[model samples]
Target: MNVLEIRNLTKKFGDFIAVDNMNLSVREGEIFGFLGANGAGKSTTINMISSLLRITKGEIELLGRNIVKESKFAKMNIGIVPQDLAIYEEMSAYENVSFFAGLYGLRGSLLKERTVEALDFVGLGDKHKALPKSFSGGMKRRLNIACAIAHRPKLIIMDEPTVGIDPQSRNYILNSVRMLNRMGCSIIYTSHYMEEVEEICTRIAIVDHGKIIAEGTKEQLKSIITDTKEIWIGVKKEDALDLEALKRISGIISVRLEEQTIKIVSKAEINNLNWIIQQLIKDQVEISSVEEQAPNLETVFLTLTGRNLRD
Candidate 1:
């Protein structure tokens, strides 16, 4: 079952179209990775799903009810852990969780029980009476998560939940996300760290120019961008390597000499390694070793988006 569904969704600002006919879906029990560079309409789409922004056109259904028609139902079923911390420094950890959970209609003993449960779930049980201002960055982030989950929404949207935290805290949050999914919550996860998404996301969607350009498992996404392969050849002296000569080889797309290594991108189906080795040997370029590179999530993101870093 799909926990969230978006069809031909769009958002416009005056004449500028922020999101253009976007369609996406997140299945129940999935940690779905939503990726995009800055200004790619990812945030706009998310805002519409959460009912924070009015959709200019199209439909978004959360758990089978159209969000526009049933905004209360949609919001009740969704939990948002914003990239920006949403906790109050003045409030005790328990009070913070209780406050947000109460907004969703949790009250009395039930609210207190869930608030304590959430604190324990995020490893903050002992600090229930502590203020967020006195906490470490990671602890604060975890508290941010506790505030979101205290209500136990069916779907959770975690936007860069690990940003600016220590590695240990990052790992803790990642494990917590897995635990949440195991406990029957569908998740929509976003992160600039490609490795994090690769490690935890069940599937991923790449948004560009206000549209989804790619959607698949890690291997599937890699396959789409693997028509070309990179072979890194180590040489004794980089200056002696002729980049032009390597580029002239059939099926070779591009070549560059970096320090003591010569990088060559070629058609994947080509058998030009032997010829390239022979040419290097003939040119008296001492060869150390050669390695064929495999495509990873970072490779897919850069290849598809034509970018080195996200804004």
Candidate 2:
């Protein structure tokens, strides 16, 4: 079943369309990875889904109710963790989480219980009395998550929740996301870290220029590029390599020279590594090492958008 549904969802500012006619459905219990380059309309679309921004034209349904019309009913079932820290530095961890819980209509003893649970869920239970001002970067990021999950919303939207944090904290956040999904809360996870997304996400969607360019499992997305491979060759003399001649190879797609490294992309199914080596040998290029780069989520992103995921 789809926990969240968006149809023809669009948002426009004057003549510029921040989000085009977007359509998506997130199945229940999925850690949906939402990815895009900077200014790709990902934030705008998510803001509209959370009802923080009004949609120019479209429908957003949480569970089965229209979010814009039945906002109170829908918002109660949604939690948002913004990219920036959304906690009070002066307030203790418990009070900060309690405050957000109150916004979702949690109250009294139930609110306190849930607050404690959230704090512990993010591994900050002992630090409940500590002010956020004294916490490390990763702890602060985890606290931001604890604040969002205190109310136990059915759907949690996390925007770059692990950015600029230590690996330990990053692993904690990623594991917490898995725990939430296992406990039945759907998540919308956005990040520039391809490896994390590739490791944790059940499915992914790539957005660019206000539109979705690719959406599927990692294997399905990779199928879009067909069977492609990248080979990296290190030569004793970088100046002696003939890049133009290499580009003319039967299955060679492109050739690039990065310092002493000659990066060659080719159609994997048809290309011959031995033939490539023979060419280098034929050209009198001193080959020091030959390495084949594996195709991965990062490669898929670069193929679809013609730019790096971080770009």
What are the root-mean-square deviations of the candidates from the true structure over C-alphas? 4.0, 3.4
lDDT of 2 by residue, 1-311 (tens): 99999999888999999899998889999999999999899999899988899989989999988998899988999999999999999999999999989988888999999999999999999999999999999999999999999988999999999999999999989999999999999999999999999999999999988899899998899888767888889988755567787878888776777688887778878757787788888888898999988778877877777667788
Model 1, CA-based lDDT: 0.90
Task: Give the candidate number with the greatest TM-score.
Answer: 2
- Expressed as tens digits, the lDDT of each residue in 1-311 for candidate 1 is 99999999989999989899999999999999999988888888888888999999999999999999998999999999998999899999999999999999999999999999999999999999999999999999999999999989999999899999999999999999999999999999999999899999999999988899899888899999668787889999555666788878998876667688887777889989998998898778999999998877766776677653255
TM-score of 2: 0.87
Off by over 4 Å in 1: 231-290
Each prediction's TM-score versus the true structure: 0.85, 0.87
- Clashes per candidate, residues 3 or more apart or on different chains: 0, 0
